[model samples]
Target chain A: MRIACPFCGPRGSEEYTYLGDATVRRPEGDAPSEAWFAYVYLRDNPAGRHRELWYHGAGCRSWLVVERDMRSHDILSVAPARDMALARGRAA
Target chain B: MLAEKYSIVSVVAQALRGQRGWKPVWREPEPRAEYDVVIVGGGGHGLATAWYLASQHGITSVAVLEKGYLGSGNVGRNTTIVRSNYLLPGNIPFYEHSLKLWEGLERDINYNAMVSQRGVLNLFHSDAQRDAYARRGNAMRLHGVDAELLDRDAVRRLYPFFDYDNARFPIQGGLLQPRGGTVRHDAVAWGYARAADRRGVDLIQNCEVTGIRVEGGRAVGVETGRGVIRARKIGLACAGNSSRVAAMAGLRLPIESHVLQAFVSEGIKPLVDGVVTFGAGHFYMSQSDKGGLVFGGDIDGYNSYAQRGNLPVVEDVCEGGMALMPGIGRLRLLRQWGGLMDMSMDGSPIIDRTPVEGLYLNAGWCYGGFKATPASGWCFAHLIARDAPHPVATAFRLDRFATGHLIDEKGAGAQPNLH
Candidate 1:
């Protein structure tokens, strides 16, 4: 599968390293252990649409949030993770 | 009554009678309104669980509900390699028990599963890898499981066709498990189903469990496509869809489903005598009785429920195969298929009671489920029948993830794909 990187155009999926579940946000330093456990281990792991983190290690070396269908491996959209985090009111 | 016992005399009698006396292997039965135990998923593990529950625990009032036909899941999709060569204390005993169960499976079930103990060898390419394998082999020996460390010349003497002289990643040695090999993957489900059926366990196919009926924090029954069937106890043996099914009961599992692909080449003369794993890469291969080279590599390294994988993994597996044995490059691949793996955070499986009362789970198998089929069933049956964790499976507690007692076998913490 070829993923369209915002900076490097389209590249083979091998160039990108996959880290799962981009939807998870890091909890505060003193957050409850339950929150930290969920952040570290739990996952929705939906069979349908999923937004995941992919690092463009072989390309622009930037982390991208790639929205794709887990059932079909079809890429729906791609954006820089920092931009998405900023837009979601989280610190970049 | 139980079906006719299979033996050499029975085979000859059947041949003389033109095989007309052979009955159906397992009976088809309608789901009853209630059962003592209800098991979700009719794959190898589910069927085996039913069999063990009936035969060992005397809990014959059991039902196994399957969404599809038997052996349609990872049981049939796996490459069929079985081994107990492990390192960790929590894993070695469990898998060793499974291996011993495999040794007596066909006789116990009265079915020819073709359980071949042809040995499994893990090749080492470097000094550090050799040292690691030596440590693993020593651990297996300490546990009374058969393990042998072979030198480079010893490996060369057994299999002379390897790319042993390659400048990069030259073959150093191997760790051999003589009792580890392959079984007929499909026959495992069939045999277990028939055994359980003979013991009065209901094998219900095409019965999809849509929802789990939870009454005041206890699972009472399940809402299936056919009808609501109540049970005193419920066991979830659903492998790939463990997280999804558990969600039906208002629970989330520490599992991520990833697609793992297996490939087979066109039937040729017997080449690979036994299972061989490439240490430098993730490829493992064995020759089936039909002469097809049954092999597989790593998972797709992504969260996916799709039963199909991308080309990158296929290419990577082929590259690993070529690097190990150059001769296989000439052979064309005949078939390739994928199965969803319920990869757990610690790369180990969980077979314990959930927080919800009367609800048990048997999931997080990752890539190791096929080999651990019998012991998983045995342990799960013990758990469901007695409401207690099997001694060997005590480490697979559901609360371990929350309690900081994770059995990180691969040392890859909290990453399902990495495991």
Candidate 2:
């Protein structure tokens, strides 16, 4: 698995730390219990490529936007979480 | 695979017996003469490295030595959370792979450690932050991953306690890493130790290395508590104690020891079911399986192996968690303990081919130690067994500082990442 961070170079996965999946939208207060449940406990566990968050705790300590294959452990791309959303419109 | 029925008692019992249903692998001392590889520190990284070296690469004659119990150091003291939402490219892919390994570890390593895919949300405040999450989410999607930028409404809906509507530090949004979750910190280390031991790796406990014997700029063997153990190759998996060990071989590293603390509240009705953070909130919290609200705040400002933090951090952490989830104000704090963090000059770890030969390192993890255990071993094994830099670790070269290619993550100062 290889991630291309905006700041750091291509480091082994060990340098960066795993945060989790990327699509979970934070629910506003007073949302339904189901929204809270989905937000807290539910996960897609998709088999194809997935978006995830990672921190380069060992490296830059910045949040990373990583695209990875659930089934194959193949990384599609890696970047800072800050830039990931805007780049969301344009798939690299 | 772990039995569906599990608890700390069951886990500890099995570990003490070394599993095959009996034959306790308890502290029975065994004399060993030699091995193919000798790895110091029985923490997760050491055990994992031994596992990869033996199982993945077929290098079976190996030994892992621990000064205390496996994970006795910083590994066990961490707040276990696995994540790959990084700001660096070189590291994202590897951790993503580690996340993949985590998903299958129960089966692959035959350890029932729950790799719960609890989501993690890093909240934001300003438009700049929203854009950051957006970019990160997009990058995740581009790399075939899943991430999305949430709006204020989305954030409020996800975390009801957050005061998104507040005028100050208005809830702009956040970056959610759902694949992230926690694991029993000790189990991860024991799991690797168990698997590696079964694969014919010698795991010597309480065998503290007093000195690293080097010859001709090559690490030759180690002087242990009992006696000197000779080996052709060696690895330093001592995260918190790395600077001391590396110094034994006359290698100077820019690692500083910083104390980190975590607190657990009295068992109570579950409030927060998953991990959530408000960088603005100054705290993060998640209820464990038993309903104890377990969490921690940022790294302690100073250095020490005191195993206790200053009163300021305790107040700061509680205040932060309370601010994020005002509902937990009544929950009593059960205990708080601190661990040493080997903070590197470049917040990123140094896994380079150091000036000394036959020596490899997997330190400088800061607060992310527990999460990156697997990937650290895999990459370190590559560096040790193959004598070449794994593509991702090439950026962590020893000369990065001298060359001014620091990969800085400490936004407060110099490049934490050696660029």
Candidate 3:
């Protein structure tokens, strides 16, 4: 699998490290324990069309939000995770 | 009709009768309208659960529903190595129970599963790894499970072919479990299916559960591709697709499905005597009775429902294999396949009732489900029949994630891929 990193262009998947579920947002410090638990443990784990976090550690060293199909391992889109977070009004 | 008992006498009699007297290993039965219990996924665990429910719990009115044919899932896709060498108080007893069940499985089911107790050796490279393995071995011995800490010379005596002088990770010592070994993976499914069928449990194939029917917050039945089938109780042994199936019941699990690949080399003369694992790397290998070397390394380290893996993991596994045993670099890989692992947050399994009424869950096995097949069924049967977690499986509660009682065996907290 090759990830077309927005900054590094196309790179082999070996250059990137996988972290899961870019959709999961960190809860507030004062959030309820149940809310924190869900944020930490629960997952939709969809079979297709997953947006996940990947770090281009070997090349550009940029964190990317990769939209890929879980069923086919097909990369649909890639964007800088910081830009995506800022666009969603999440503190970068 | 009940299946005939398998014995030497029966084998000779069948041979004399031109093998025509032999019946189908299991009957192809139509789904009943209702059953006392319904088990999803006709893999090893599902079939074993059906058999135990009928034989041990006296719940013969059971049905095991499979979307595909029996053994089509991870049951047949694993490397087939079975061992109970585990750490942690919560895990050792449960896996030890599974190992003991594996010991008596062939006789109990009257099937030759080829349960070979050759031994499983985990080789350590560094002094720290040796101390860690010694601790794990002590834990296993304390639980009455067989474990031996072998010195480097002892490991060399067992298998002299290892790269003992590798510069980066030289072999120093190892941990040996004498009772752990491999079984015929496909026969496990067939044997359990036959035993369950003889006990009057319906083994329904090509039955896809599309929706789980619930009434007033109580699970009543399931809407299948064939038709709706009701049951007083439901058990989800569908590890690969656990998240999707549980969603039909309005539940989300702490599971991420990842692809784990296994490979077999071209048939060669028997070389490796038992299972040998590289502690520094994730590679483990054993020679099958067919003379093929069966081996695997880590999972692909990503969330994927695809029953295939990337080339990078293949390269990584081969590199590890070459580093440990350079001689195997010449062997040609004949076949490689992937199985979906239900990686739970804690790196352990969950075998308890869901919040939904009349529903039980047996999933989150990660990549270790094959060895736990028998006890998984045993505990899941106990839970569905008695509405309580089996003694050994109490730590696998569904609410443990919420309650912060997670059984993180690898100490890799909340990271499913790392586990």
Candidate 4:
């Protein structure tokens, strides 16, 4: 499969690493047990289109926005997260 | 000696050559049918993908076809270590999200997938390794991940028995990642399967894929054991056999199979507290909560679906681990297992669209598949469900190999100590 990363450009699926389901958002502290479970392990497992997160570890080592068909690997678009595109890691 | 034989090499060798009871008989070809979505490989990634798709995106009709039981592939064979202290901007965040996901996986999936954060450390003896650790620690700090640089004294404090002043591969200090740990690998797949199954997804076990029925540049369905299950879309989570699986669609993923072995010592008193990796020793060891020593080493440099590897890497790993922790040298290894690591040329992962219209891929994870389970499912699910790449995984595309835009992480100065 072809993955179009933001910094590394479009590369083969072999060059990137699949992290996991990106939909589960870990709610900040103080959420209920159901909310925590939903954020932690709950998922859609959609049969059609799904929005997920990926990492292009073989290239720029950047997270990728992989828009693909769950029924098929037909990718529609690839980009960075809403706020993370501008976030660059710094040396501690 | 660095070049010697391991105890359980014979069994693994037989398993690889189709001698043992578990040779993979790929599903034969059959008529195609059309369904909404189909996920190949019943490993952790594929099952998690199904779970995410059905639960998050409201894509109800999904099928996960596994060549074997839930995680009989690399999922079951991996050395279930979990850490997010990556130096790369992309990997650090992606793995950090995965680490967070692991903390609550058991409760979330309603399965006891023992995710433990017992701390992990990468010992640095050389100036170059130290520099790399500093850079990596900085990246972790930047991403709000818990990481720190420990001096030799701190290292000695944490691990007193380690020979701090050894003449060979001296331990100067280490980069400590307190949040890193291990999990029950097989349980991860089972837990995800149970969760997905509970949410109304059909998991067809022992269903091998003979061919990807693609028509007019689109994936029509798959030929499986239960006959042709027409899938509107397909996700390839086949790791070790990724190349063969993709070839059914007439595509060759740029992946080279490498055999990776892991060993476990007879249950002894817990001699180690956390995962200890020798930066220069090409070895790493982690004491399971049950007091067994989980060990692994560098990837056996060869290409094939041969799940068994040569004995040299195993010996090297044990040598390195023993060199660092001399106190554990007397413990006998109970068993050792080998798995095929679907190693990509660039030493990363691929999660994107294929040339075929209806097929997506999430393979070529190399030796890091276990830790990236949740995140891989999330990204692959996003790519399949929304028809768009997540903002985070923008770099790993199939075209990168063709264009020479590889994310080579196995080269010199790589943040991963084992490589």
Q: How many residue pairs clash in each candidate?
A: 0, 86, 0, 93
Ranking by DockQ: 3, 1, 4, 2
TM-score for all models, in order of appearance: 0.98, 0.75, 0.99, 0.74
* Model 2 lDDT per residue over B130-215, tens place: 77778777766665555666777887787777666555667777888888878877888877877777777888888998898899
DockQ of 2: 0.01
Candidate 1 lDDT over residue span B1-419, tens digit each = 56778899999999999989988877788899999999999999999999999999999999999999988999999999999999999999999999999999999999999999999999999999999999999999999999999999999988899999877879998999999999999999999999999999999999999999999999999999999999999999999999999999988888999999999999999889989999998999999999999999999999888899989999999999999999999999999999999999899999999888999999999999999999999999999999888998888988788899988877999988888
List-wise, what DockQ does each model earn?
A: 0.81, 0.01, 0.91, 0.02
TM-score of 4: 0.74
Error of 2 at B92 (Å): 1.5
Which 10-residue window in model 4 chain B sums to the lowest lDDT?
B23-32
Query: Could you tell me the TM-score of candidate 2?
Result: 0.75
TM-score winner between 1 and 4, please give it: 1
**Candidate 4 residue-wise lDDT, B245-274, digit = tens:** 887898756564556888889888877888
- After superposition, the stretches of candidate 2 with alpha carbons farther than 4 Å from their true spots are A1-92, B1-31, B415-419
Could you tell me the interface RMSD of model 2?
A: 20.4
Looking at model 1, the pairs that clash are none
lDDT of 3 by residue, B1-419 (tens): 88899999999999999999988878898999999899999999999999999989999999999999988999999999899999988899999999999999999999999999999999999999989999999999999999999998999999999999999999998999999999999999999999999999999999999999989889999999989999999999999899999999999999999999999999999999999999888999999999999999999999998899989999989998999999999999999999999999999999999989998899999999999999999999999999988999889988999998988878989999999
Docking class of 2: incorrect
Best by DockQ: 3
TM-score of 1: 0.98
User: Cα deviation in Å at residue A59, candidate 4?
Assistant: 37
